[model samples]
Target: MSEIQEEAVLEQDQIIVESGRPKMLGYVFGFFAVTLLGYFLVNRYYMPAPAVNTAPAVRFAPSELLNDLNKRLAYLQNRTTGVSFYIHTIRKKENLWKLASKRHYSVHAIIGCNPQFETYDVSIGQKIIIPSRAGTLHPVQKNDSWQKIASRYKTTLPELVKYNNTALDIGYGDLVFVPDRRPDMALMNDKLREKYELRALFVSPLGGRLSSTFGRRKHPVTGQYKLHGGIDIAVKTGTWVGAAADGVVTLASDGVGHYGKAVFVDHQDGYVTHYGHLSKILVRPGQKVKARQLIARSGSTGRSTGPHLHFTIKKNDVSKDPLKFIW
Candidate 1:
C-alpha cells in the first residue's frame, strides 16, 4: 500500500510542473512582442524628416524698375540740391523765432511755407511745414517764367526751378519755392506786410468789453444789414482814447460822416488808424502823435447805441478787421 501512494504523488507533481513551463514561455513571448511593436510605431511616426534645399524662382520687370530708379534718383538729386521739407507740430512755449533759431533757418523761411502766418506768432498744436534751408515761396503771376522768378529771388534759374519737383509748367497762383533766399520784410506785399507790422506796432488804445465786432452785421441805428468796418469797445462817456501807433494826424473833427467826433492817423505805410465815436478830439489835423498818446475821448456820438470807442484799421483806404492789428 505505501509504494502505490508514493507513485501517485510523483505523477501529480510531474503533471503540474510540465503545464507551468508552457504558460511561462507564452508570457515572455507576449512581453517581447509588445516591446517590439511600440519601438516600430515610435520609429515610423515620431521621427522628424531631414530638410531639403531648393532655389526660388525670380520675376523681373524692366519698365517698373527703370521708373522706380528714375524716381529715386530725382529724389536724391533734389535732396543734394538743398530741397527737402519736414513738418513740425508747434507745442506749448514754441514760437517762430525760437523754432527758426533752433532749426538754423530764418523766420521768413518758415513764413514762406505757411501763408496763414500773417505774423511771427504761432499757436499751440499748430502744424507748420519747415524747409531744410532758409527761403520763401513766391506765387507765380501772369507771364511768370523760371528765369524771372530766379532773378527776383537773386538765385539762378536752375536752382529756383529745382525747388519745384513736380512739374515744369507754372500758371497763375502756382507757388514756386525759392531756396536760400531770405525775404525782405519791407519788400513783401504792401497789404500783407502792413498787416504783419501793424500787429506788433499797435496796441489796444482802450480796454473794455467788445460791444461790436468788425464784420457784416445789422447796424444798430440804421437797422440795415451792412459791413461794420470797425470794432466797438464799450466804455463810459469821456473815456480817454489813445493813438494806436506813432503817426501823423490826418483828420480830427467833430460830427463828420458816421464817425461822430473822430481822429484818423496815417501810419505812412498804406496803414491808417481811425478812432471814432468820441466825446472830444484832442489832436488837430496835421499834428504828429505817439503811440498811446491821448487822441480823443469815447462817447455815444452819431449812430451809436452806447458810449464806446469805434476803432478801425485801413490798408490802402480799405477798412480791415481792427482786432487783427490790435487786441
Candidate 2:
C-alpha cells in the first residue's frame, strides 16, 4: 500500500479503538495533508541551493611570459643617456673644406654631425648634434698596438702603422699615441679656398681614359713591363694638371729617364707628393701650393705617348695608394 493510504488506515484503526463512535475519513485526509505540508516546509528551509557556474579557467603559458620579458629587455637596451645638443644641416657635396671656409663654423664642429649623415655624402634636411671630440685620440692606460688603435678609430691598421713607422705586429701593454692631428685637413680646405678657388681635389690628370692603375703596367713609352708607380690618366698634350695637396713645390725640371717635366712637393707631414709628365711647369721649385693649385700643364714630356698626370704619394720613402689621402 502507498504510504499516504497506509497512514490513513492507521488513523481509522486508532479512532475505532478510542470510541467506534466517530466517522474518521475526514480526519485521515487532514492528517495526510498536514504531513505533506510539513515535509515541503522542512525541505525548503533546511536544504542548500545549487551553485551557478560561470566562465572557464585560464592556463599559464611560459612562452607568452618569455616574450613579454624580452620586450622589456629590448626597451631597456635601446634607452640612451647623455647630454644632447643641436647640429646644423650639411648640404649635398659639402665637405670639411667647405665647412672650414665658413666664417661662423668650424671643422671640429662638423665632426659633431657625423651620426646624422647616412653616407660619406652629408644630406640636407637632416638633424644631428656634433659628437664630442673622439676619446682623446687614443687612450693611455693600456699598452696598445697599432691594429687595436686603428680599429678604435674607424681606420685601418696599415694606415696607422705606416704613419707611426711601426711594424704590422706591434706588441701589447706598450702604449703609444702614434702622433695624430686632424691631418690639418681643415687648413688645406681653408688654403684651397683662399688660393685655387677650385671646389675640387684633383685637377685634370689627363683628357684621356685611365690606361692602367697605379700598381703595375707596361709603360706606354718603354714597353718593358714595370711596376707603374702612379696612375696614367691619358690626355693629349697641353692638358692642365694641379697639385693634389697643399705643400711646397720641390722639383719642376727634367726630360730625364722616365719622368718628363716633373714636379715634386714636400707636403711636410712625413709625406712627399709628386706630379709628373707635364707639357709646362707653371710653378717653380720652393713655391707654396694649395690643393688644385696649377703646377703645370700636361704633355708627353716624359717617355709617354699621351699626356697624363703621374701622381704619387710617398711616406718615409715608401710609395702608397694616393687615394687614401685624397680629400
Best by TM-score: 1
Off by over 4 Å in 2: 1-208
Indicate the worst ten consecutive residues by lDDT in candidate 1: 50-59
**Could you tell me how far off, in angstroms, the CA of residue 214 lies in candidate 1 after the best superposition?**
1.0
Clashing pairs in 1: none
- TM-score for candidate 1, please give it: 0.43
Residue 77's lDDT in candidate 2: 23
Give Cα-based local distance difference scores for all models.
0.73, 0.52
Best by lDDT: 1
Clash pairs, candidate 2, are 112-130, 112-131, 113-130, 143-173, 143-174, 208-234
Candidate 1 residue-wise lDDT, 55-127, digit = tens? 2212223233123433323332442234666667899989887788787876778877565455666789877
Q: Residue 258 deviation, candidate 1, in Å?
A: 1.9
lDDT of 1: 0.73
